[model samples]
Target: MTLLSTLNDDMKQAMKAKEKDVLQVIRMIKASLQNEQIKLGRELTEEEDLTILAREMKQRRDSLAEFEKAHRDDLVEKVKIEIAIVERYLPAQLTEDEIRQIVLQAIEQTNATSSQSFGPVMGLVMPKVKGKADGALVNAVVKELLNNL
Candidate 1:
């Protein structure tokens, strides 16, 4: 099933189960998906849906960080639960080693010998890593590789 269909089914199950937290999270996801469809004036492809899910996951991670810094353990726990719910729909994420391997390959393919070539390598890398890797991780890897060059 498409992500949308699976989400819809989960929404129904949440409603029946009277799980407020899960239902609320699912509603926010549905709203985000709907907003994207409205913004583009067309249905979303699976890749587009994955992009939206990733964006949502990123937002939750940012919020979690802020909550932690503020010493709001209660809020931090809540956000962690939300993050878990959001992750259910996303594809399996790449391990650090896997991402580094891909970055090395991209660098090789793009002949990225220095910082100047980082952009070119990233352009070739992001699409291949999308949904499976985090941007911050990739950026850090690329920076480290470029710095050593």
Candidate 2:
């Protein structure tokens, strides 16, 4: 099933179950997707859907970090839950080791040996790991591997 259909079904279930948190998160995601669809003036492709979902995940993570720094335990916990819910829609995430391997291959493919080549290496790796891994994590791995070269 497409992401929208899955979200709709899950939303209905959440409503019947009276799951306030889940329902809220699902609505937020649906709103984001619908807004993007309207802006693009067409149905979103699977990749576009994934991209929007990933963006949602990133925004939540950023909020989580800010909440942590502000010492707001209540907001921190709620954002964490939201992050978990957002994760449910994303592809299975890559392990650090798996991401390392992927980055290594990308470096090899691009013949990138230093931080100077960071752009090319990142360009090569991001598409391969897109929506499957966090961009920040992949970037850190790339930097560590390349700097050691």
Candidate 3:
């Protein structure tokens, strides 16, 4: 099944099982997907769905950080659970070493010798890494590789 269909199936299961937290998270994802579909006037491709999932995951992570800083362990735990749910829908994340290797390859392909080539290098690399890696992490790896060149 497609990712979207899997989500729909899981939502039905969650409802049947009376899994409130899981149901809530699934509803949030569905709402976001629906909103994006409306905005674009088309059903989302797998790539677009992954992008939305990543964005939701990022939002949860950011909320987790804030909750941590506020010492609200209860909220932190909730956000963590939400993050876990969101992560289940994302592509397997690329490790730092893997990202670095990809960045190196992008630099080579772009013939980017310095930071001045950041834009072109990112343009080339982001598409390859999208939905499989976090943007901030990829940017750091690219900068490190370019600086070392």
lDDT (CA) for every model shown? 0.91, 0.93, 0.89
Which pairs clash in model 2? Answer: none
Models 1 onward score TM values of 0.96, 0.97, 0.95
Comparing 1 with 2 on lDDT, the higher-scoring candidate is 2
Model 1 TM-score, 2 decimals: 0.96
Error of 1 at 62 (Å): 0.3
Which prediction has the highest lDDT against the true structure? 2
Tell me which residue pairs clash in candidate 3. none
- Considering TM-score, which of the candidate structures 2 and 3 is the better prediction for this target? 2
Tens-place lDDT per residue, model 1, 29-70, is 999999999999999998999899999999999999999999
Which of candidates 1 and 3 reaches a greater lDDT? Answer: 1
lDDT of 3 by residue, 47-72 (tens): 89888888888888889889999999
| Over 4 Å off, model 1 | none
Better of 1 and 3 by TM-score: 1
lDDT of 1: 0.91
